[model samples]
Target: MRSLGVAVAYPDPGVADELVHAVEAEADLYLALDPARAAVVLAGEEALSTLGEHPADAAVVGVAADRDAIAVVARAALRCGAHEIVLWPQDRAMLRSIVRDAATRARIGAGRAEGRIVAVAGARGGVGTTTVAAMLARAVAESVVVDLDPVGAGLSGFLSDGAEPTLAAVVAAVDDLDPAALSAAMAGHAAGRAICAEPREAAPTKQQAARMLALLRATVPVAVIDAGRAADDAAMAAISLADQTICVCTPDVASIRGARALIAAAGRGFPVVLNRSARMRLSAKDVARVVGAPPVAVIPDDPAIRRAGEAGRLPSRGAARRAIERLAGLILAEASDGS
Candidate 1:
């Protein structure tokens, strides 16, 4: 483990001394003379204005005098991008934990090659975006899925054991998000790992969404994000960050119309996947004509897929699995070429 540099700034002389002492007590922490170069910054209310000068990834702590002062500085600290607020002398242990976690993330991200990001979004609700994203991730080696849907069946419910420290906890601590924090939030899946969304929880801000994706890029070889219908900031952020965006829709008229609208709204045409294409009058060419892009993959409706998903796994041998495997190969090839 690498020692992290910490810079402290407090208006009160006594509080400043205590903070310095606390930093010195930690073997993995050291005082830095410059705030811009430090890995962690301890800033008082008066010092909040200078936070903008520090690195964007730097862990910022707002020092509060007591419980009363916390309320006064909490909103301001949040606006100034402080990761957490700690009371002097009382929350020393919490401060140590925050700094150490930041250090660990910094060490892990250092010199790591950023991974390929793929976003799968539905033309409308119930178009199988989560299924496609999860299956594609499963087909690829060393991949992880992220659920950015704000109001849908959670990805973990079907793929994972519904573990704690979910996306709700991650967005709550977005500013302090690190590789370790993200790893803790993930639920292990047979396909890979997943950060499941909490449908009832508030959506992450654009900055929070971007930060999460950036951390994922640093932590894994491939990240597949289920953007649902791209109705929220997190979904939009994933689409924007992805190396490839796959727009999934069925062969029905409503689904094709929705895909057209979504593509128009995005101002760019994404590769289309005609999912559940069966017994419909519209063909792949018809969808291609309407969406302005040829269908990249057409997955047939398979009952086995639904059964396997309900059972918390993907179909082992079926046409659905074969189609998903082909899509995964295309994504991997694109990622390799881009790399």
Candidate 2:
């Protein structure tokens, strides 16, 4: 593990020294005199106001002396943009854990500027969200497809030819989530691809879901996640952490209505992809108007898709593949623009 650069600020030198002694093995301790250079800022309740005054880019962790004082300090810390608040002595382990996470985030964030995460979620079941996600993963170099759909066919089965450890093992090691751990958990597939999807038995917790995405993003250039129908906590976590969330829907009234509701609930700027079926009557324009955002990409009904699925092969070339590639380009463009 890389050493975390932590800035310690407290009213008493003895306390700061004690903190340094405790974390010195894991972190590179620094005085909070120059907060701008620090990855994480640790401040006593009294010194919390100083953090606000400086307004550094580092994540702030406020320390309170005891449980009784923590509530007041926590509110103040939050108001001052503190990432977390810790009760000193009582919550030492928790404090260290938070600080370590903050430091890891800071380190990974600085290393990569284009490791974008694109999550695909279905407005309703059977909307081809997993297909789109797998296609997008194929379009991107050094990409991984993470399946958060507990009930759906695993991405490994749909996309990969080889088998290895699944996401079940990864979630089991959530506390040690990193590039190496994720790589070990990932299953090898054809065409130089990797995927992290396991059986439903090893579903991750909400925090684990978020951590999985964060750590995966640190290693790969693009992470294409099939978030399924958002019926579970892990799916919800994937949606929340995604850089770009693509809601896939058919052009039917029910699908459009569900997509619209999902888009509204997902907040502004999340794009929708219209997957046209053979029995579709509603136009792309109608779908867009209902969803409140112009369609980013459209996939028309293609028998090639069905044929490929039946043959247990991904669509290599066809209208469907072309459409998915176009959608991938649009997602890449958006990621570039945001970066």
Candidate 3:
């Protein structure tokens, strides 16, 4: 684990050294004059008055030798963003535990700074956008599939069936979502995790959708969003927030034209995935020229895919499965490289 930048604000210099040494290996513990940059800040009761104001997000700890003094100092520290209060000497073990936990979380958060939110949008219906998104999600270690298509319900059945909390419930409380709440809301599948959106039901605003995606990426390795055929504000918000936007399309005339228009609307440099290219009207290169975007992946048509869907199973082996796995690898590799 990487070390965390911890700041100790104590009146007595000797006591500060003791606190710092307790968790030195886990954190680059020091007495910080600037509390803004520290991941965890230990504020003694007497020193609490010195920290006028600091970042609300930083984990602040109140330290005091006297039990009565800890309560008094904690109340003051709370106004300055103290999340934990501990009595010194008596609570040294607990204090070290808290600091170590905070340091571990800080390291995790820093690592998650590279998390990617990829949006898979279809030019028109039946282009296998949801399938591509789900497959790519399954490739990643920790991934969440957000089904923004209210009508398709493809994602709802893509994963393992369960009566988990729906996306609607999560959107209702978008302003107050925690890690536990989000994990509970998402339905588990053998392939990966999914949060199915309600049909024809509008709950999350565009801003809320952005926040939800951001939170998901913060918690998970990747967030694969199936933005369906809907071009609503919420869907647009998802595309806007995505680290990469992939437009899925077949090589047919209508699919090509629709894909071109969707890519143009989405903005320049957005990649396209030529899916179901068995009886194609044009090649991947031609499709790219027409769409004005390069083809990031090409998934061949396969009857086994349909059979797997009917059997409630993902394609275990075949050209389509292999292609999807390759596409998933490409997407994840690109994300890793960029990060």
Per-structure clash totals for the candidates = 0, 0, 1
Worst 10 residues of 1 by lDDT: 104-113
In terms of lDDT, the best-performing candidate is: 1
Q: Each candidate's lDDT (Cα)?
A: 0.81, 0.73, 0.74
TM-score of each: 0.67, 0.66, 0.80
> In candidate 3, how many Å is residue 255 off?
1.3
Q: lDDT per residue, candidate 3, 59-80, as tens digits?
A: 6788886777866887777766
Candidate 3 TM-score, true structure as reference? 0.80
Predicted candidate 2 versus true structure: per-residue lDDT over 149-258, tens digit per residue: 86774565664555763767777777766665666666665324555565556567898887778787766778888888877888878888788898999878888888
Model 3 accuracy (lDDT, Cα): 0.74
Clashing pairs in 2: none
Model 2 spans > 4 angstroms off: 1-106, 109-114, 190-192, 277-280
Off by over 4 Å in 1: 1-113
True-vs-predicted CA distance for residue 181, candidate 1, Å: 2.5
For candidate 2, what is the lDDT? 0.73
Error of 3 at 209 (Å): 0.3
Clashes of 1: 0
Candidate of highest TM-score: 3
Candidate 3 segments whose C-alpha is farther than 4 A from its true place? 1-37, 51-57, 61-71, 83-114
